[model samples]
Target: MAERCPYPFPRPTALGIPERLTGIHDEPLVPVVLPSGDEAVLLTRYQDVRQVLTDDRLSRNLDRPDAARISRHNSMFQDPRINPDPPEHTRVRNLVASAFSAARVQRLEPRIHAETDELLDAMERSGGPVDLNEALAFPLPVRVICSLLGVPDEDVALFRHWTSAFLSVSHFPREEIRAAMTEMSRYIAEHISHRRAHPGDDLVSAMIRAHDDEGRLSEYELQWWCRLLLLVGYETTATQLGGGVAMLLSHPEQLRLLRADPALLPNAIEELLRWKLVGSSVSMLRYATDDIELEDCVIKKGTSIIPAADCANQDPDRFFDPRTFDITRSDNPHLTFSLGPHFCIGASLARAELRIATQALLTRFPNLRLAVPAEELKRQEGALLEGFTEIPVTW
Candidate 1:
């Protein structure tokens, strides 16, 4: 029997696409062991990754008795929205889709700007040498999501704790993961009950109306939807924000270009998204519903396939000078946000937050520089998310 490839596959560095991932483009699919100790096929090439992501035969139904999981801990808390097929997935996604539509996200821009400014104000007051992750990157997204969810100020810390614990896949014990899930579920349930009694303009209250008035959403679906939104809404944005800042700081020329021309902010954010490594090396666990043939291999039914978006984003075939950090690069079709039905719903909002936060930081702290050597900067290890644990900086 062939040796089973270990999960994560060993990256060359803490930053950028892993060299191992990019080096495997010639192969159709590589073997890997998931955090759950399940052996799976890992797709690296841009075409293969896109094919697997778009193929309906490759399902996200992790609730199956024999579903493959990224980790044992994730198995216990798979959100139905993430693991179901249509019409169930369709139903759950549609109920809250409008809430995240471009129009809705645009309406929140003023609020996002205000929040960004407020956080920058706090960071500025802290004098020099502050961790941007704690002051801005982390808190900004959390505050926005909490406000949208109608979560009270006192409970923000609790939600953060739960989310941090929940994403710590291989790092934390299984019991801790379960405990965080329990507390998060309870907290959402309680707040949802409150929203039912006293409706508000917030997203949670709107979801409650969908459940009570329209009957479009069930209680179980509603709770998990809130949990999914809360966890994803902030987590991805927070990590990306920190990574973006670090990326800019690391590349002074790009930072200078961005500061000289703020019009580049939008495209710069796109490049940043394309360049940064936000999540795990692998995409979410997708199980094969039936035998599926690719260029060089057949994925047996029930086999899990993880498409490495990090690799696809930097695939040399798809991206010219893929490794170069060029803010002006166009025709850059990166899969940092995986494609298909599961494409990030919060993409617009995330873009807005990153642009606003980047603009705010550059405009406010004109001399912002890393407080420590880039190599010395710490990162959150063993979590599904990949980002700096703390980005210490001074202006």
Candidate 2:
């Protein structure tokens, strides 16, 4: 489990996290001593991560050197997203909340279903051995977001490249990532200008109107939010879709069950999101603002703590049969999207996309099967947003 992660640490994967924390019921949290001579607190217990997320004592600022060292600055965990507390976080979250309300998302179901069918049609027309990730998984979120943002659908490839460069854990260098971010920002800024000149009923135009009318978000806020919406909103869902398909392929019986009864998809998607590993690795790097003591270690102020959400989700105290993947598992409380005040604001929209996606796909192509061996397949490693580079499948 630890060897899979190249970070020179003993962080466990989603599959191995449960077994890693066996018999540690006596302790609430465990201390991880990295090979780099750095110490971090690994919160394996579900309740513990929830407590810390809601706790006022812990800070989420990743720029602090003393904080746990993460590899990248994802928008979700960036300074703007993580540093603020209370009213500020509430303000930012609320401003974006209306953009993804339940009623608004509900209206898009038909269109999403249409898009899903079209993509599936293209895949089926291509015959067997099609890359599901390329065909269905990635395009769903990309097209949805593009439609919502009023961006030209043809530009998806460019933005996709930027999204890849933005959170990529490997291949691209630091300079390359910086350049990609700059180019993406410039493109978005131009789009903002264009939307300002020509107001439309899209998210960017709506935000522009909000800024003009209410004067809520500043330039940075608006730009950051736009970037956040496009990148986080798309990548997370896209990657999760890819990972979900991979999981279903790995468990053919579960896939069969899903095919037999499409009603089980909602809960099944939740379980998959809870169980699957997305992004490069699981380690929350938080700087200690004050001295704190856990079971075995005393972390001083300015020390970094790495809490493994993948591990915490499988805590025995919180989940029954932690290692087993049961879509119908009752009382399943996982921290895949995180918890507390800083919980994912796009939760509802994401779930809707997944539910609509999973159900539509399984119902459309019940014979969908993996075109390649699971172990032989490659996954995007060392990136903030973890997903497959490509998921090959056949119908």
Candidate 3:
């Protein structure tokens, strides 16, 4: 017999966690020690995921406990508002939200369109059998974030490699991840220094001004914020673009519908996000600060609980016909950008980029199709955020 696959994620299986958890199970609350020797409870149900997300007993910042220091580098988990309880998290998040307002994102639409077109133009010139992942998906968000944050375009490729290393889960040594993150921080700090001397109309410059006008943000705070924003800005959106293109290509009929009805673009983006079933694990692991009881079990304090974003999004109870990829799926409430206090700040800008990219892609190459079979394509493995390593497309 073949070796048994790992529990929960259903590696080498068709459906992912949603199926594994909902399938036959021996126990209600399973306990597994992670490679780091940290104890955690892997949740699968929508109700369970939501309860953990909303529960006051659960903490997003595991680094709070002296014993739970998982990483030395500062992380979003360090942002008390993102992962902390009550007033601390609230205060910090309020300060962060000022930088990501709806009005501010509205101004980004034109830039998003221009960036999408530029990439598409390059893609057209490169011709078919092009790797969309390299040509478009990978670079689009990097360029968008660079344009938004005022980072020089030349720095993006190196930063992309650094951020990629930061998020890597492969058997690559932990020290390597740390070094990459440190390099990323150093690079961003240098840019911050440059911007302080000569401010521009980018997000980092705006943040530098904010730091100057009032002592609202510390130098360290600004540095970490820039690093945090850039890492997330590229990694998540790149996954979306790669995954979204895979989804569109997989469902050509939906692409046809989208091409015919450009008005359906917004809804289609939601559907695309839902269809991918990405986010195999939460970006940040939430720790139970105290004993917390759900319908089935009581989670002990000091334990980590990772909410299944993909599972919750595909929960049949929450979403009707959870498997289908309908471009016009009317009642799409995906947690892809997540929900509540920890929701993604750049969602509007991300949406604009996706909308423009998708619209322009189908318009420019109406006959776009995969150059190879789906099974033949390689997906980047050993990482929580997954996408095609190279999506070769022919038009």
Q: Which candidate number maximizes TM-score?
A: 1
Candidate 1 vs candidate 3, lDDT winner: 1
TM-score of each: 0.94, 0.88, 0.87
- For model 1, residues 1-395, the per-residue Cα lDDT tens digits are 24667777555544555566656677767787877787787777888788888889988777676766777766534555454666777787887778778998899899899989999998999997999888899888888888878888777877777877777767788888889889888888889989888888888998898888899888788988898788767988999998888888988999898888888888888888887557565546788889988786787898877877776777788888888998988687777777787788788888888988988898899999999877776667667786677888999
RMSD of 1: 2.0
Question: Best candidate per lDDT, number?
Answer: 1
Q: TM-score rank, highest first? A: 1, 2, 3
Residue 267, model 3: Cα distance from true site in angstroms: 2.0
Quick one: ranking by lDDT, best first?
Answer: 1, 2, 3
Give the whole-model CA lDDT for all candidates, comma-separated.
0.80, 0.70, 0.69
Question: Tens digits of per-residue lDDT for model 3 on 1-395?
Answer: 12223422543422222455454223335554333444555565567777677777776666665433223332335554343555655655676675567787777777777877888888888867788878888788888888878888788888767776766655346677778877888898899999999999787887787688877666766787788778777777777777677667877788888878889989989887775544465454677778988787777777776665666676777788776778888998777776666677777777777878878888888888888876575666555465557777999
Candidate 3 TM-score, C-alpha based = 0.87
Clashing pairs in 2: 68-304, 169-382, 169-383, 279-386
> What stretches of model 3 exceed 4 Å from their correct place?
1-37, 64-86
Give the distance in Å from residue 125's predicted Cα in candidate 3 to where it truly belongs: 1.3
lDDT of 2 by residue, 58-138 (tens): 776655555544443333354643445666667777877787888888887887889888998887788768887888888
